[model samples]
Target: MLENPAPPPRTSPATLDPSAAGAGVPCRAHPERTRIGNRPARRRRAARIGVPTDSPELNWLRQSLRACDLLASVHSISPSDRALVAFAIEWAPYGGADTEDLFIKFGAQRNRFLHLLQAAMIPRPSDLGHLRNLKTTLCNDLLRAWNDTPPHNEKQCRRL
Candidate 1:
C-alpha cells in the first residue's frame, strides 16, 4: 500500500480578549450601584408596649387592637372615653379589679362609666375559665363591626 500522504498542517484557533474585541462598545451595566450577593442591613424596631411576654391572652389582645379596624371608632370617642377603653384593653380579664380606679380616673359615676364602656365597645372577660375566649370574641366583634371579617378560629382560641 502506498504510504499515507503527509499529514496536513494543523491550524490552531486564535483566542480573542473581550476587552480588546469590544474596545469601542460601551457597557451599560452599573454593577457598583446595585446590591450583589450582599443583603441590606435590617433596621431594628422598638418593642411594643402593654403586653407581658409570658401571657398569651394579653399578647393576642394587643395584636388584635393593632390590627382591628375599630380603631377609627376609638378615635371618634371623647379622649377620656378613649383613655378608659385603652386601659380596659390593657386590663382585660381583670377590668373588674380596676373598676374603682377606672371610675375615679374617668370622673364618672359607676353606672355612667359602665354605660360609656359598653358604648365604647371596650372588652372585659366575664369568666376566668373563658377569659381568652371572651377576649377573642371581643376582637372578632371589633373586626366584624368595622372590617366585615369573621372571628379567628385558631387553635390557640380553641385551647381556651
Candidate 2:
C-alpha cells in the first residue's frame, strides 16, 4: 500500500487576514499578494506653452526649459519664458484678418504674423496713449522688415 503523504501546511489566522496583522488587504484579483501601501505616482507637470511639433525652435526650447526649470523662479524672467509665450501665441488661431475672393484663408503663417502683432510681451501702461505708441512702433518695425526684401517674381512663386 502507498504511504499517506503528510498533510498540507495550514494557514494561520494572521496570514489569512493580512489587514488585521497590519500588512494591509490582499488585492482581490491577486489574493496571494498584499495590497500596496503607498499612493500612486503622479503625472509629470507639463509646460504651459504650446508649440507645433514640426518647429525646430520649439524642440530646442523644450529641451532648454526642461534642463533649467526656469519656471521655478518666482520673480525672474528668462528668455525661455519669452520664447514660450511667443510660440504659444504663434500657434493660436486667428479670426478673419483679410479676405480672398470673399473667403478667409487661416493658416500657420497668418497666425504667426497676427501673434507678432498681438502678443503682450511688450510693456505698456493702462492709458490708451501707451497702447497706441506700442502699436505704431510694432507696425513700423514689421513694415521695415517686410520692405527690406525685394518683391518675389513669378519664378519664386513657381519654385514655392
Candidate 3:
C-alpha cells in the first residue's frame, strides 16, 4: 500500500492576509483543495459600480453643490425649503433625484416636485457662494431636460 503524505501546516486565522485570497473574494480555509479528486473552483471577478455619463458643467455642479460645508447662510430659508435644498444637495451628483424617488421621498409628483425644488432654491442666500450659482445651473439643466422629454417628438430647443 502507498504511504500517506504529511498534511500541510495549519495557518493561524489572525495571520491570513485578505489580499492574498483575491480582491473582493472573502478569505476562507480550504486545505483539501490540492487533491486531484477535487476540481479547482472557478474565481469570480470583483463586482463593480457603474458611473453615469455627464457633461463637464454637470460634473462641476455636482461636486460644487455637494461640497457646501456651512449652513449659517441658509437660515433665512423655510424648514421645508431647507429640507428640499439638503435633499437636492445630497442628490446633486446623481443629476437630482428621479420622479419615483421624489414621490417616495417627498410624496409629490414630478411636476409638483420640480415646482417645490424651484421654490426651495430661491431662498438660498448669496453668501452661499457657488451654492447660489448652483441653484440657477441645476434648475436650468433640470427644467431643460424636462422640456426636452416630449410625448413623442424632437425637442424644439432654441438655447442659442
Candidate 4:
C-alpha cells in the first residue's frame, strides 16, 4: 500500500492582515480615497493581470484599458486574431466602479458617455453588476439591444 502524504503546513491566521489581504491602495493622483475592503474578488483577479504593486492607479487603469487596445492592435495587424475580437469588446466595457465618478460627474454629458459604453459588447450581466447601478443599467440595456439586433452573429453575442 502507498503511504499517505503528509498534510501541508498550517498557516497562522493571526499573521494574516485582513485589511491588506486583497485591498488596493489608491494612487495619489486619483481624487478618491482608497478604502481597503471595497474591492470585489473579480476586480482583484482582473487587476492582477498586469498591475505592479508600485504602479499608480492611473497606470493600473491604463493597463486594463490596454487589454482592449491590444486586441484592437491584433485585429488591425492580423485578421487571424479576429477570433479574439469578442474578448476585446468585452474587456473594453469591463471596468470597475473606480472610474465612474470621473466619467459621470459631467451631469448632462454622462448620458452621451454612457452611449459610448453601450457600444462595447460585454460577455456577462453578472460582470456588469459588479459596477454601480447606473453602469449596470446601461450595460443591461446594451445587452438587450444586442440581443434584439438582427444579423445574429454567434461570435458577437454575449451570454448574460
Candidate 5:
C-alpha cells in the first residue's frame, strides 16, 4: 500500500463527486485556478496583441499602455475599446485621428465612431485622470472637426 495515496483522478462530469469538489463548490486547493485568475487570463488572451504604441514623441499615456505589466485600465476595458483608446493616445499629439483613419481602422464613420468611443469610455473608471483627459481632449477635437466639416460631399476634415 502506498504511504501517501494520490487523490482520485476525475474521469468524467457524470462521475464527479460533489463532496469531493468541496461540496459542489469550487475546489480552492489552487487559488490560481479560481474565477478571478481565469478572467484575467481571458483578458490577457483577448489583448495578447497589445497596442502598437510607437510614435515620434514618447508620452506618458503611450508608455503606460506599452508597460510590460498590463495596466488595470487595459484589463477593465474591452478589446475593441482598447483599440479606440490606443488610437486616441497615438493621435492626441496631432490633434486627433481623422474620419477616414477612424473608418479605415474601426470600420465606422466619424459620427458613428464618436458615439462608439463615448459609450466605451463611460464604463471606464474616472480616477485615471490621464486617460480621462486624453479621451476628453480627443472627443472634443473630433467633435469640433465633425462640426466644421461641411455635411454634404465632405472629403477632408477642416483643421483649426
Candidate 6:
C-alpha cells in the first residue's frame, strides 16, 4: 500500500469538451506522452572549407535576383531570343550552374559586375536609374583599384 495516493492531474480547459460536460459523458484522458508539448531542437552545421553557407551579402544578392524585373522579363522571352543566346548557341559546349550561384561563389567583385551588367541590360522604360547609378559608382571605384595594378606586357610574358 502506498503511504499516500496522489490526486489525478487536472486536464487543461483546452482539452475539455463543453457538450460532454453536462451530459454525464467522460472525455478520453489526454495522453501522458504528448507530441504537441515536445519541440524539436534547432541545429546548424558548420560549412565545409571554401563553401559559403549563408551571409547578409548572399541574402541581398538572392533577394535582388528574385525582385529584378529585367531578369523576369528575360526569362519570359523565347529561349532563342534571350540576351545571351548568341554565346549559348556558338560557345557553350557544357552546361553549368546559373550566374546567381556563380556570383555567390566568386564574392563581391563578381556580384558588382553582375549588377552593372543587369543595370545596363534593363529596358529603357523600366526604372533602374538608381541601380544604374549605384553600379556605375561601384564599377568606377573598382576601376580605380585596378588603376594601381601594374600593366602586363605581352613580350615580358613570352620570355617567361
Q: Model 6, residue 158: what's the lDDT? A: 14
Candidate that would win on lDDT: 5
lDDT of predicted model 1: 0.46
Cα distance off (Å), candidate 1, residue 47:
12
How well does each candidate superpose onto the true structure, as a TM-score? 0.36, 0.19, 0.39, 0.23, 0.38, 0.22
Cα lDDT listed for each candidate:
0.46, 0.37, 0.53, 0.40, 0.53, 0.37
List the pairs of residues colliding in candidate 3: none
Top TM-score model? 3
Stretches of candidate 5 above 4 Å error? 1-57, 60-74, 124-160
Across residues 1-160, which tens digit of lDDT does each residue of candidate 4 receive?
A: 9986998888777448777654675555643434333345535766788644445644444443444344345332133333223322233333322235424532323334433444443434443332334333334533433344433443332332
RMSD in angstroms, candidate 3? 16.4
TM-score, structure 6 vs. true: 0.22
Ranking by TM-score: 3, 5, 1, 4, 6, 2
lDDT of 2 by residue, 13-50 (tens): 88687577755545576444333222122111122234
lDDT tens digits by residue: candidate 1, 32-149:
3332221121111112443344466646655645433244343433555556555555555443324467566776665565455555543334334344454445544443332234
Candidate 3: lDDT over CA atoms? Answer: 0.53
Error of 5 at 73 (Å): 6.1
Off by over 4 Å in 1: 1-54, 67-70, 73-78, 122-160
Kindly provide the TM-score of model 5 when superposed on the true structure, using C-alpha atoms. 0.38
List where candidate 4 sits over 4 angstroms from the true fold.
Answer: 1-53, 76-108, 123-160
Q: Residue 122 of model 4: what lDDT?
A: 43
Q: Assess candidate 5 and give its lDDT.
A: 0.53
What is the C-alpha lDDT profile of model 3 across 52-105, one tens digit per residue? 335575456445344322332455345666576567656654656788898898
Give RMSD to native, each candidate.
Answer: 23.4, 19.1, 16.4, 17.4, 13.1, 19.6
Off by over 4 Å in 6: 1-54, 74-119, 126-160
Model 6, 1-160: lDDT tens digits are 6575888899977459776555754435633325323212211222434435466544443343333333335453233323332222122222323466445643334335434333333333343655444333332332233233332431221122
Arrange candidates by lDDT, descending.
5, 3, 1, 4, 2, 6
